[model samples]
Target chain A: MEEVLRRQIEKIVTLTDEEFRFVLTHFTARTVKKHQYVVQAGDPAPNDHFVVKGLLKSFYTDDLGKTHILQFAMEDWWISDPQAYHNKVNATLHIDCLEDTQLFFISIDNREKLCVELQKMEYFFMKKTTAGYIALQRRILSLMSQKAEERFNQFIQLYPTLLQRVPKALIASYLGISRETLSRMSAH
Target chain B: MEEVLRRQIEKIVTLTDEEFRFVLTHFTARTVKKHQYVVQAGDPAPNDHFVVKGLLKSFYTDDLGKTHILQFAMEDWWISDPQAYHNKVNATLHIDCLEDTQLFFISIDNREKLCVELQKMEYFFMKKTTAGYIALQRRILSLMSQKAEERFNQFIQLYPTLLQRVPKALIASYLGISRETLSRMSAH
Candidate 1:
């Protein structure tokens, strides 16, 4: 589990064993079963989870009871209600395990302290956040410009692994297409 | 113009006069007229612009010649082809001035150097990127769940200044609604 996080950090910045150990102290580990909720709407989202194993998804349920998948986090990915966590507000999104999951979770306070104590971690986080910002911009463009078939093709190209793991109906929800439309596209 | 950049940075982290001057040295200023292109598709997007005056928009033109507005940058906002800028790839978006504009622009290399030299800047950027990520998530949820009228109302409430300045047709395109639909809703 620690290896997963160390590898992720090493991808951007090199850290000595002592530095890596210090970083690890700021996080806590957790194991959750499938169907367990890590974050739920109306509760404070105090920690950001870094996935070590298995799958989890964050989503919002609309007034009509329609669920829209915001994101899916697998190994080496991070997931959280970023707004709630950063702003210290009640979560507007729910995050639950799709498979029995192992994660390292860090509260905002600890994360900030780590960044302050280790300048490298601040650079590491900035790079991650910038990459995430770029990805969300790309997703917005895809949502605005792509037709359902095009979006499905793009999704498959981007996350072929996810296609195998996630339910097709949930994938349809993430793409904002009807399940019928997804089925038609998948058939083609 | 330098004061604008300094003020923005100071909002997140206070800086002494010497430090602010050091930060300013990394950026260059430019003036662009209405309809002028700051970034164009297929060109390398090497710089991110910070708006000092006037408005600009970034958009993608689809294969079918339909244009989709990805973002709008007014005074004090930042605009760039984030993917292209960060990944060192050719731009997939075009950014053009909606009105005569003044901007302070920084290349990715200079920006990185600044962050490395000043830890506070790195923190400022991480906060800004996280805020951008959260805003994009909110937009995705709104797009998935809201009706045209609800989106329009949300847009008005969030960016009343933009509604007064931007063309209604462009606003309709941004909201993924037809111009006719926007007209009908605005009338009511």
Candidate 2:
């Protein structure tokens, strides 16, 4: 688990063993069963989770009770409600495990303290957030212009592992396509 | 123009007069006439711009020749082909002036150097990127679930200034609605 996190951080910035140990002090670990809710709508979502193992999703349930998948976090990925964690507001999204999960998490306060204490971590986080911003821009463009077939194909191309690990219905929601349409597209 | 950027930075991090001057050294200022393209699709978009005056837009033109507005930057806002500017790739979107515009910009290299030399700038950028990520998530939710009228109303409520400054056709494009539909809604 330590190696999982250390490797993730090392991809962006090299850290001395002492520095890595210092960084670990700011995070706490947890294990959750399948179908567990990490964050619920209208409640405080205080930490950002980095998955060591298992799959989780963050979704919005609309007034009509229909759900839309905003994102997914698999092994080595991070998940959080941005408004809740960063702005200290209640969550507008629910995050839940699709499988039994083990994860590490850090609160906004700890993250800020860590960034201030380690300039390298600040740089690491800046890069990660910038990359996240770019990805969301791509998603917005795809949602605006792509057909259902194109969206599903792009999803498969970009995340073949996610395609298998994630349910077809959830994948359809993430792609913003009807389950029937997704089924039709996948049939080919 | 220097004061514009100074004030923007100060919103996130404090800087003394001398420190602000040091920060200004990394940016270049430019003035562009209306209809000029700052970033064209398929070209290198090397800088992230901070608008001091006038209006600009980042848009994607589809293969079928339909254009969709991704975002707009008026006074005090930033605009870029996010992927190209952050990832050092060619632009996938076109960014152009909607009016005569003046702005300050920093290249990715200069941004990195500035961040390293001044930790405050790194914090400023990290906060900005995180906020950008959150805003994009809201947009995704709006697109996925909202009807055209709700999307338009939300835009109007969130950016009253933008509604008046932007052309109806472009605003329609940004909202992912047809011009005629927007017209009927606006009429009411």
Q: How does each model score on TM-score?
A: 0.98, 0.99
Give lDDT: candidate 2, residue B156: 95
Q: Per-residue lDDT of B1-188 in model 2, one digit per residue for the tens? A: 89999999999999999999999999999999999999999999999999999999999999999999999999989999999998899999999999999999999999999999999999998888888899999999999999999999999999999989899999999999999999999999
**lDDT tens digits, residue span A92-137, model 2:** 9999999999999999999999999998999888888888898899
Clashing pairs in model 1, backbone N/Cα/C closer than 3 A: none
User: Largest DockQ belongs to which candidate?
Assistant: 2
Residue B116 local lDDT, model 2? 92
Residue ranges of candidate 2 with Cα displaced over 4 Å = none
Angstrom error at residue B70, model 1: 0.6
Best by lDDT: 2
RMSD of model 2 against the true structure: 0.7
Flag clash pairs in model 2.
none
User: Fnat of each prediction?
Assistant: 0.85, 0.94
Per-residue lDDT of model 1, residues A71-155, tens digit only = 9999999999999999999999999999999999999999999999999998888888888888888888888899989999999
